[model samples]
Target: MNPRNRNILIAAIVVIVVVVAGIIGVTSHKKSSANSKTVNIGIMTSTKQDDAIWKVVSKTAKDKYGITLKFTHFTDYTQPNKALQNGSIDLDAFQHYAFLNEWNQANKTDLVSIGDTMISPIHIYSSKYKDVKDIPDNATVAVPNDASNESRALYVLKSAGLIKLDVSGDALATPKDVTENPKHLVIKELDAAQTARALDSVAASVVNFNYATAAKLPENQSIYAEPINKDSAQWINLIAAKKSEKNNKIYKEVVKAYETAATKKAIKEQYPTGGELPAWGLKLK
Candidate 1:
């Protein structure tokens, strides 16, 4: 073969190799990108405040697991779980085990917890009285009316030594379950959101952490706080979804992204008053 013809043939082969290599590289890049997707999460938060912890977790999810966190807020407590069940959202982070069980029993939905989130300890707040023991007899004290929270509030009152419950074990105790009210205090049941507002009129009100925070109530002023323990284990917050999707890989990844050191730090920083505490195998300070 002539020298010019040999050189042309070599150049043509090089160009074809470069084109084939470019196509393969593009295809691989696209496939990797496809692994990344968005996950919609329903959150029932009282405050519209910017969530710093979620921001950190979301960044980690995107950078590491290729999942983007999209949060949808709801004012009503009953909405998130229902939304998750009906396929309106991918997952939800709100209710604790007790609350979830009550919801499941009532609605006949079998949503399962995917991972532990944080336990927002229930608190008894009083503007009029400095201590639980200071409240006068027959004084009105408000508590959340929802089945799960109402029972939890009653237990908190019992823990404060003001009341006694007739039931034991996992059975939720209500105001009627109060075998003894030494003070004969009037237990006024109100919506969880209204408990904070009723603080002015009532001797003391049992308020959820989120509702207390939303009302800008000082945490230090709380007369009594429910201790986190074996009894309160059911109150530990968690991420939940339809029971059928309990073992989904991407959902598991989302949980891993959230239950991290970074997210834990953010929770502490965001809730300096310790109203919210991480529940996933972390020691409480």
Candidate 2:
């Protein structure tokens, strides 16, 4: 073998090695970029406000972390968690801790909350009476038939001095726990979505903010609305995902976006009377 030919062969081998290494590097980088790209989120509804919030989050995610975000809104609460559990959604932001807990317990799923979003204050509205004291003895009060919100209604009634509950601490309380009914408030449990409409028939009703908002009955119009500082286990609305996805980068970014000043400002502006207070905490303690 001649010296020139040997040298050319060695140079050719080096070039080939470099080219292969470059190809491998490029492939790996592309895969990494693809994996770290857009995050798909599931929300309750695809309204204008939800789109606006998603835009803010998408911008933040892209600007801060070079990630894009997509939002998917479900019309019902049951499907979002089911979607999360089934790995259809990366995360969800429409439910409170109580609903999540109840679903988890009932379905034996491992969905967990990653961060707090905003508290949807429950309100007790009445047309026949101005306050709790005005209700006649044994007055029928309509409450959401759902477990969590029904429990919340009972707590509100207890708070209003209409009933005495046997439960202690800030855990979820049910109607069965009512030890004393000074007003003899007959709890006429109705579907949560229907509680707002029941206001016309019942003496008073405990209404969720969403239904209340839908009914055009803001919190200010209610006879009583839950206060901001009340941490009575019912106020902890949260951002949730499957347990396996809890610590993902996208989840953290979503949490950051949710906790941002802009998000809080939007919440206050959007739901001033509904008492949509912030809850930055995610983990249960």
lDDT string for model 2 (1-285, tens) is 999999999999999999999999999999998777676778877556556655766777777777777777789878888887887878877888778888888999988888877776788898777876778987799998888888788878877778888866645677889999877778998989999898878889989877877788744448876655454545587778888888887678778866787776676666564456666643433
- Residue 105's lDDT in candidate 2: 89
**In candidate 2, how many clashes are counted?**
0
Q: Which stretches of candidate 1 lie over 4 Å from their true place?
A: 1-34, 45-50, 282-285
Report the C-alpha lDDT of model 1 over 51-94, residue by residue, as the tens digit. Answer: 77788889989988989899999988889998999999999998
Q: For each candidate, give its TM-score against the true structure.
A: 0.84, 0.84
Output the TM-score of candidate 1.
0.84
Ten-residue segment with the worst summed lDDT in candidate 1? Answer: 44-53
Candidate 2 segments exceeding 4 Å error: 1-35, 168-171, 218-220, 229-231, 281-285
